[model samples]
Target: MHLREVRSNQFKLLLIALLIILCMALAYRLLIVRKNLKIAQQADELQEQKSHLLEQQMALDSLSRQLKVAQQDNQEELRQKQSEYNQKAQEVELLKQQYIQQRQYLLRESTIYKKIQKSVSTPNPDHKELLTDKDWKAIYKCIDTMYPSLSERLVLAGITPTEKKYCYLSFFQLDSKLEAFLLNVNIDTPYKNRTRIRQKLKITGSEEKLYEHLALWG
Candidate 1:
């Protein structure tokens, strides 16, 4: 009976050892499965992150392309505007030059007209003798009939009873191919006074030449 009881205790210890080994094996298998699941979750998260980064990169590249295109378009527009402005400026400058030339031409014409009017308005010495209005009018009529346009100029030069004895009359032909005649009158007087008068009448062009001719006669 003692040997049987000892055998029974030995059997109990073997069963306990078997149970411990089975528990160890099950725990190891469960840890390996949990580790594998964790690894799979990490891989999925990394893939999602990579996909998001790729989308962002694509969006940035598209925006960059658009910005470059906008810059190029702006540059082209600026160049066109600059070219147009230059053309307009050149045209304006040309117009300014033309305007200046026209103004100068008008000024010269005005000056010539003034000189002619001054010559015509001078008083005639001969008209002083014809004090009566009717007589003066008749003399003016005669002068107009003889010289037409230059009648007033001729009367103003020296046409009076006092001047009749000293004044000589002549006509001048101009070289401008116009059918115009200049009436010339000379005052012959004391030689010294005549020289003074001649010097005063020394003008330009045909008028000067005529004055010199009259002086020679004096």
Candidate 2:
């Protein structure tokens, strides 16, 4: 009986030892599982951060592209404006050239311009007029009062007048200047030149001209 009781006690001890070992192994497995789960959660969080970074990079690239495109568009607009300005400047230059050419042509084609170019001394002096001494006195008085400065500058040419219904007179210095001021005279586009041409006068020289006036003999 004693031997049998000893064996029973030994068996109980062995069972307790087995149960402790089993509990230790189960706790170790639980700790390993918890560690693995924590590692997985950390890895997931890292992946999410990497994805966010990638999205930001893409957005930045898109914005950069947009800015580059905008710069190109602005440069194109500036080029267009420059082209338009250049074209307009060229047109204005062309128009100015045309106007100058036209004005020069018209001046060359004028009859007075031809006469000024070809005139010589004593341009057709034997012209006739109808005037009395009273008319001459009246003209002298007008010249003195209306053009006092001119009277001081120019000498009046002497003219012989009679009741013979025709007379001729010559002018002294700056003769043609008086033609524009003559109002009470009838000229048939034929009158004696008061001064000679080609005496450093006419357009090619000092811009002087020879004009004639014809009065009806009454």
Candidate 3:
């Protein structure tokens, strides 16, 4: 009976040892599963970060392309403006040349201009003294009709009503100046020269003596 009881006790002890070993094996399996799940979660998070970085890189590339296109457009516009400015400058220069050519042509076509040019090139003292009595009458008529007050003033200054040939010659020259101006002849003589002549005549004290010695001409 004691031997049998001992065998039963040995069997119970073996069963308890097997149960403890099974529990240990299950705890080891749970630890391995938890470690594998943590590794999967970390991999997923890394993939998401990589995708975000790729999206940012694509956006930067798109913006860079747009900036390049904008720069090209601006350069084209600037070139167009420069071309237009050059064209306008050329047109203005052409207009200036045309106007100068037209003015030169008109001056060349003018009869009075030719006469004055001829007179300047070949001066003739005989032409100055070729005035006839009719020409003298016309000169006196112009003075009486156009410059009555100046004629009266000259007569009062004792420069008129004289038979001196130089005095009549001076009067004819003065009348010729008026005719040149009325005909729009572009002589270098300004009206100031006429004023100087009149003022000199007004200031002269002795007209007969002045005419005799050609002092007035001097």
lDDT of each: 0.42, 0.41, 0.47
What TM-score against the true fold does each predicted structure earn?
0.32, 0.31, 0.30
lDDT of 1 at 125: 49
Q: Compared with the true structure, what per-residue lDDT tens digits does model 3 show for residues 46-145?
A: 3454445446556555555555555567877656555555555565556545543433343343333344345444544454533446545644543233
lDDT of candidate 3 at residue 176, scale 0 to 100: 43
What is the C-alpha lDDT profile of model 2 across 14-67, one tens digit per residue? 999999999999999998888657645644553454445446556555555555
Worst 10 residues of 1 by lDDT: 173-182
In candidate 1, residue 115 scores what lDDT? 40
Residues forming the 10-long window of minimal summed lDDT in candidate 3 = 209-218
Top lDDT hit: 3
Worst lDDT run of 10 residues, candidate 2, spans 209-218
Clashes of each: 2, 2, 0
**Candidate 2, residue 176: how far the Cα is off, in Å:** 99
Clash pairs detected, candidate 1: 126-159, 126-160
**Clashes in candidate 2: how many?**
2
Name model 3 segments beyond 4 Å from true: 70-218
For model 1, residues 104-164, the per-residue Cα lDDT tens digits are 3332333232343343355554533213344335333332322233443324554344332
Sort all candidates by lDDT, best to worst: 3, 1, 2
